[model samples]
Target: MPLFRLDASIMPATSQSRALADLVESEWSAENPGAAVVRRDIGSEPLSATIWREAVTGGFAAEADRSPAQRTALARAAELADELIEADAVLLAIPLYNWGVPAHVKTWYDLTYTDPRIAGGALNDKPVVLASVLGGNYNPGTPKDGWDHATPWLTRVFRDVWGADLRVVQRQFTLVGVDPAMDRFADQAAEIKAAAEQLAIEHGRAIATQVQSLAA
Candidate 1:
């Protein structure tokens, strides 16, 4: 199956999430050689906030009375929806930031609603892989336990609202070598990082397996 990947990290070249996503994409590409890997980097070139506003406001306006801006917004919404609807499965690589969802990530979904296919649930059964990265550990018993608000929300949007079969792979303690304060945990962080990379490769294979199983 063709792969659709979305990267939502502001650090285009150096994002941990993107690096993990690269493993999945690389495996998927190997499995389905020459297949198109459709991608959109919302972190760097996000859909405008204005586009989302126009889409929402234009929804209430009469079709014939809508302004040119509304028309443009509607057009863009359709384009985004097509990307989702056309894909058999998708991989969304996002990072938890400031304990919440990134603005660009939220915007992507809010605009997804503007398209009837998504809002009306026309595209409800595709499988999805959520590959997320976080700066610090928030696992159970950690001080920051339950502090993550992004993963659960993303889960709802894809699995519940959009009805996509979903799987998640997360890499935490990503700030180990970056922040000076976490230097003490550096050794443990390296171990976690290695494990995360191995998991990424497995998850990538898992997607290909799932898609092939569906075909069978």
Candidate 2:
């Protein structure tokens, strides 16, 4: 009955993604009191950049022929895979950086893909909520439309690739108030924030219910 939560925000204190995730987690907590929660803050405790390479190489070599680093990398991959496999539900809070997925998050995906079970769709039919935030608006018809390279990729991985029963809660224009130049979008940002927050809570409750049903 464990829930796995992963946060990938370098600035934890001021992270809008983390803020949204907190709302989701709060709702989940209300539904499942005292339930186990496993957390991994990749931004604060990032995996080694070389782990993916080492694990990939290790996969091709005999156990006795594998280097120590490769062996360690493979073991780490298995551990990451196990975390997700054992969880009843998962919540991933990630933010867009430079219009793309953060480097550390990408590394995590790469390393985890080394595990045979994960790569083979271990999360199939599992409940997952992806809470993501964007610094600027990237909706269609906006100036930055089509510039968002993170969400689509994330959706593909979580929904299509892993076959998760996925729900996405996303907020845009998160920098409207922070950046003076974007003050004109304050009202729009407020609306988007409100909507995203509501969705986060709803998704949280939905996942919790689904998990409880599965357990029952």
Candidate 3:
């Protein structure tokens, strides 16, 4: 079985989201070793704004009638679509940047949306692990309550639009050491992070069992 992992963290080694995702991969691999893992780092390599225009133009025009730019755009769309369509389980690891989903993630969705091969029901209820890391808390009663725009938009895209079966593992209050302004909540950050990591490991185990079942 193939596992598709989409990592949208700007930070490399120190990225909490990516670290959690790696745990997931490791747990899943332990269950079924040698499974192929496909990695896509959208933060480092983002889809250009021009891809949208190309995808749109290519979508409207026939293959033979498409311009070189349009063809390239369509090809890019296909690349993304095939990743999800071919995966047994998907790990969508992302960081909430400025209370919003990363620009590359949105652009990726836009590009895939225009492609003909990847339709509304393309994923067919594929299991998706939504591992999200947020710098600040957005839970109810918090100062930034109801301020999260990233997870919601992703919910619409992964659940409503693509019909994926999503399991979200979110870590909030993550700006403990980075932003001096959030120094007050620094004390609780370690505990919160540990809990999230444990949860991610559990979900990863569940995913491994689920994927193996599907293959059986």
Candidate 4:
């Protein structure tokens, strides 16, 4: 069975981000019963501060060249990188924080993209699907809409650093008052939720079908 990795970074369980993630997982699992689905809740397991530091350091260090704490941190980062490399597909549920991805999600990307061994040319040809939920409406040519920084940054990282072909399906303008009336917000949210689920399922099926084709 092929492995599908889902990373959810939303702090609250009922957060819009988690809602999208769950919808994706549920729909995909329903379609592919034998497939392996693994969930990583970054808010709960939260990467250590050292991982962020190592990201700043450029790469991991030798086992014997560091304190026990540092070694453990390096090991965790390596494990995450290995998981990413081994997975056939990846789903990232990103929620906006101050006009960008949450801090932990950014940290995860930092760790994922900084490893010289796992990165460089190794990530070539990998496929990534991004599901982003934003609090405000930033749909091109609005007053507050100009502040959207999530998709662009994600696209650059997936293509430039990870060497992956990335597709982003997003749900934006979730916050109240972003639109004309509050009533419309509920409708839009529900619509976005449905769209996100469908996209996730499509992404899963597409990746699985691709893998099957490769094996043939």
Candidate 5:
């Protein structure tokens, strides 16, 4: 059975981003029965700053000491990387903040991608799908909304560093104000939520199907 990792970093349950993440998880569960679904709530377990410091220091001996905090950080990073390595597919539910990914999500990426062994080895050839929820209308060729810098950086990290095939399935500009709302505001929100969930299921099935084909 394939493993599906859902990364939810948003603080509020009511947050559109968090909602989308939950929706994706639900869809994956429904479509991939008997599959292992691991939900990594980064908001609940924030990445330790000590790890960030150690990551920047680049000192082998410092990391070798295995200070309690450093050890925890290393362990978490290793666990997350191992999970990614074992999974046939990855889905990142990202919400735009200040025109970029949330800080917690970025930290998650930093932790998972910085490990030289995992990034350079087992993570290669994995397939990733990015599901983004944006408050404003942002796409290519618009003044207010253009290519998200975070998307390209993420693409490079997975492709260049991990040698993974990353496909972006974006649900862009779901905010009601930017686009025309339905008769009722709640109705529009529901429509957007449903669409996002459908995309997530489709993405999950696509990855599973691809993996099966490759195995065959």
Candidate 6:
């Protein structure tokens, strides 16, 4: 089985989201030893931000009437979409930036969505694990409640739009130890991190089990 993994962290060396994703991926790999894993690091190798606009226009234009840029953009969109379409499962390691989705992730989704296969629900029922992290707390009753604009949007796209069997693992207060101002929450942060890590392990094993059952 092929697994498609996308990392949207600009700082992979110290990315909490990537750490969680690693757990999930390791379990999947253990279950299917030597399985192919396709990786796309959009944060480091970002897509052309302008390509999405060109792709949209290209979709409306005739082949002969399309500009060179438009043709190239459309082709790129197809390539991005093909990766997910061909995958048996997917893992997205994304961190909340500025209380919302990273610019690179947004651009990637925009360009990929222009592809007909994805728009037609090619990812329907595909298993997707989204490992997301936040530097601050945003739970209900907290000061930042409802401030996270990334998780809900991500769920909408994956579960509602793409029809994926999505499982989300989120870790909040990631900056508790790193940021001096949040030092007061060290104990709470540790607890949250531990719980999230455990969830990551469980979700990873579940994904592997689910995929193996389907293959059987």
Provide the clashing-pair count of each candidate structure: 0, 0, 0, 0, 0, 0
Per-model TM values vs. the true structure = 0.95, 0.98, 0.95, 0.82, 0.77, 0.98
**Model 5 bad stretches (over 4 Å):** 18-31, 55-59, 62-66, 177-198
- Best model per lDDT: 2
Query: What is the Cα root-mean-square deviation between model 2 and the actual structure?
Result: 0.7
The predicted structure with the larger TM-score, 1 or 4, is 1
- Relative to the true structure, how large is the alpha-carbon lDDT of every model? 0.87, 0.94, 0.87, 0.66, 0.65, 0.94
lDDT of candidate 1 over 1-216, digit per residue (tens): 678899999987889999989988888777777778889999999988778899988989999989999989988889888888887679899999899999988888898788877988855777688999999989999999999999999998888988888878888989988889998988888888898888888878887877778888
**Candidate 3: Cα lDDT at 187:** 69
> Per-residue CA lDDT of candidate 5, range 1-216, in tens?
465555554555555655555555555556567778656667667676457555534434465565666566666777888778778777676667777766877777777766666757666677777666666555556666564666667677777777777666556556665445522455645666577677766776677666667777
lDDT: which is higher, 2 or 3?
Answer: 2
lDDT per residue as tens, model 3, 1-216: 899999988777789889888888888889879999999998888889788888897888877999999999988898899998999999988999888988888898889877666675887678899999998889899989988999998988888888888888989888888999988887688888899999999999998899888878
TM-score of 1: 0.95
Per-residue lDDT tens digits for candidate 4, residues 60-176, read: 455556666555556677777877777666667777778776678777777765556666656677666676788766776866666877778877877787777566767765665
Give per-residue CA lDDT, model 2, range 8-109, as digits (tens).
999999999999999888899899999889999999999998889999999999999999999999999999999999999999999999999999999999
Candidates 3 and 6: which is better by TM-score? 6
Off by over 4 Å in 2: none
Worst 10 residues of 5 by lDDT: 177-186
TM-score (C-alpha, index-matched) for candidate 2? 0.98
How do these models rank on lDDT, best leading? 2, 6, 3, 1, 4, 5
Q: Tell me the lDDT of candidate 2.
A: 0.94
